[model samples]
Target: MSVCKVIVMGVSGCGKSLIGTRLAERLEVPFFDADDFHSQANVAKMASGVPLTDADRSGWLDDLAELVRVEQKGLVLACSALKRAYRDRLRAGNPSLQFVYLRGDMDTIWSRHSSREDHYFNGRTMLESQFRALQEPEPDEGAITVDVSELPDRIVERCLSALGAPDRTGES
Candidate 1:
């Protein structure tokens, strides 16, 4: 998809990885899940149901931002990006980077999360904490907000359609 950069973002288990993968395939770009970039210590903390402080996330965010900055072609990164500051961090020096917000209720996401058997972020409490930290991308942020409740194909189609026309909903 012509050097299109996008971050599929939401809480821990709102299908970021899943949808990000599909989107990347459609766009013919690489897909990276931020969970794969977490430090061992941070992964352990979340695995034990502990919420991370901003300090704990600093290095990780830097690493992701570096990846975004250095990548030569387009890519879709699946990241929680729960806070606006974190999103802004990723955007540094990568102003054209767009975001796809998987907007969903706690119950729907919790149901999807609970069914996972091998994910590191598996705590319900941690999910709640992420929601608390969430800052949905605003209209001016040049983002596409899609419902997570729909079938995956529909979501991907919506993303592709929205992407085909930038600024259709302030997404350029």
Candidate 2:
């Protein structure tokens, strides 16, 4: 399989990690969580139901960009790159970067978030903020936006297809 870097990006509860992990496994590459790059203070603030300002996210975005820049081979990264500016930052140093946007309705996201347990993003308070901050990827942005209501396997299939994977015509 040809290697290519992809970022599974979307709002909170949009299954960025789940899809990114599956994509990584399918591509035989490492998976990185952008959340892991956040500073302790950022995590603490989010845990406390605080919305992060663009200034607050600058460092985190830079770190993610660096990861993309330094990866010798393609890797999958899960990040809530909600804003165009943030996405641009991630793509700045890595000209070959591609984004797979896990798009979903607000209601669907809220339902998923509500059912989850022990996540740092507590499903409430930040939903509105996330939506407010979201800037849909333009056609010119070169992102493949997929609705994430499908099963994990199907999602993975679609992502692989988006990445130009050949048709096997065997598995469901």
Candidate 3:
């Protein structure tokens, strides 16, 4: 079966938007950036170089989960699913939902984040805090982690190829 519902997840500036959009295009699904769902307070907090607490993110995550819950067709969402609990919350929307965890080191992601000119991500402080909060998905989580250093097309290709592959239970 083709990729129907997926989330491209990682820390901020990990190319979630670019890769998620491409993956959505490849899968013929609608794409959404989780940042678009953030409340103004969340944006303002991040803009001021403050890291968001779990409390700050609670409602935002719920909104994103609701987006997943309501979509009947293929859906691709780019979100910073840093914690396992957050991913679990998102999964409550659809149990079969797949995740594409963009894995990258601090230096690489910081480089990318620094180059960006038009986002609320204020400085390295926010990035560092994200690293602190990140809970990389384990083998059992069913997330396919992809390295972000590769070219965009190659990353998308790998995602599609992996998503097309069967899991441990041999179900597609």
Q: Who wins the TM-score comparison?
A: 2
Worst 10 residues of 2 by lDDT: 163-172
lDDT of each model, Cα atoms only? 0.89, 0.88, 0.90
lDDT (Cα, tens digit) per residue for candidate 1, span 127-147: 999999999887788889999
* Tens digits of lDDT, candidate 3, 1-172: 7437899999999999999997887777899999999899989999999999999999999999899988888799999999999999999948879999999999999999999998998999899999999999988999998999999887888888888843223211
lDDT of 1: 0.89
1-172: candidate 2 lDDT, tens digit per residue = 5558999999999999888998888787899999888999999999999998999998888889999988878899999999999999999978878999999998999999888887788546798789999999999999998988988888889888878966755654
Better of 1 and 2 by TM-score: 2
Query: What is every candidate's alpha-carbon RMSD to the true fold?
Result: 4.2, 1.6, 4.6
Q: For model 1, state the Cα shift of residue 129 in Å.
A: 0.5
Candidate 3 local lDDT, residue 24 = 84
Q: Candidate 3 — worst ten consecutive residues by lDDT sum?
A: 163-172
Q: Which regions of candidate 1 fall more than 4 Å away from where they truly are? A: 165-172
Model 2 alpha-carbon miss at residue 79, Å: 0.4
Candidate 2 Cα lDDT to native: 0.88
Candidate 1: count of backbone clashes, pairs at least 3 residues apart or interchain? 1
How many pairs of residues in model 2 come into backbone collision? 0
